[model samples]
Target: MATSKFLFGLLLLLILVEMNIIEQPWMPGVEAIDCSGKCNYRCSKSGRPKMCIRACNTCCKRCQCVPSGTSGNKDECTCYANMKTHNGRPKCP
Candidate 1:
């Protein structure tokens, strides 16, 4: 019975991972996300891709994560969401 329960738990954990309900832990240096690629995608719709990419790079370096879409997904990465410019506006696109 105990063995069966353990197996069930392990199976459930695997399913969660596969479904992306659970994600791998973040550890800098151990794993690095493709910031350039992610930022490019995130900034693709911007009028100023160069400026957007530059700001995104800075935010990604600090937060180690980028929001999942081209826009309005800042809630996905709080650090990115919270970043501000000198005038106290959202910095990351």
Candidate 2:
């Protein structure tokens, strides 16, 4: 019984270590920022705030970062830089 408990504890430790070593897809670069807040911050400067939030939220959810200003700074997040709408329009604000 004691040997079984020891093996279970060892397995649990391995899992914890593995989790610490892996990086999350949503937080590729910068420290994780709340997508909703990022979207709101950028959209505030937009002429079309509602549309900007909608678009920014989509990109932020995927890329986990919002570009600076009202438009065009996609280099910060490669995923956001590459995104496109169904109509081929830029997807991120």
Candidate 3:
């Protein structure tokens, strides 16, 4: 009986930890930004991909772009490109 109770408690703890990890926001993955058309032009002309990445990192916490293949993970996070226009042009490559 005691062993069963300990196991149950351990399981509960593990579950709580898992929940926390799932709930926490995740940072953007490498190769996350897609420099297609306008995005590439803006980044190249302005030289500000790092700034865009930073902005996206901050905004992604609240907004959801796309879900990840991994369970309970987000594949795409919200970024500036999605939010604002890029110099009246389309995305770049």
Candidate 4:
């Protein structure tokens, strides 16, 4: 009886370990995409570098990436590029 209990405990432990080794379940757009060092746009020329940085950071946080420059690299992330204003203008700065 003691041997049987020990074997059962070992089997349970192995099952738990196996579960941990499995891949995380599918989660869409749940993880933060890092966009470090990618906000180097011409925001300074816009006379509102601070505002540009804030807008860039906001978009980067959502898309996990940034475009190449200030004007038109929206191809990097469709979600970021497609983000629009109430009047249908691009919202990212």
lDDT of 1 by residue, 1-93 (tens): 999999999999989866767665554244558999999999999999999999999999888899998999778999999999999999888
Q: Residues 29-76, candidate 3: write the lDDT tens digits.
A: 422333333233334434567664454344333343322322223224
Tens digit per residue, CA lDDT, model 4, 1-93: 999999999888778756765333544435544554566453545677777777777777776667767667688778788877789988776
Order of the predicted models by lDDT, top scorer first: 1, 2, 4, 3
The candidate, 1 or 4, that scores higher on TM-score is 1
| lDDT of model 2 at position 55 | 84
For TM-score, candidate 1 versus 3, the one ahead is: 1
Whole-model alpha-carbon lDDT for candidate 4: 0.69
Question: Whose lDDT is greatest here?
Answer: 1
TM-score of each: 0.66, 0.61, 0.26, 0.53
Each model's lDDT comes to 0.89, 0.80, 0.42, 0.69
TM-score of 1: 0.66
Q: Which stretches in model 3 have alpha-carbon errors above 4 Å?
A: 1-46, 66-93
What is the model-wide C-alpha lDDT for candidate 3?
Answer: 0.42
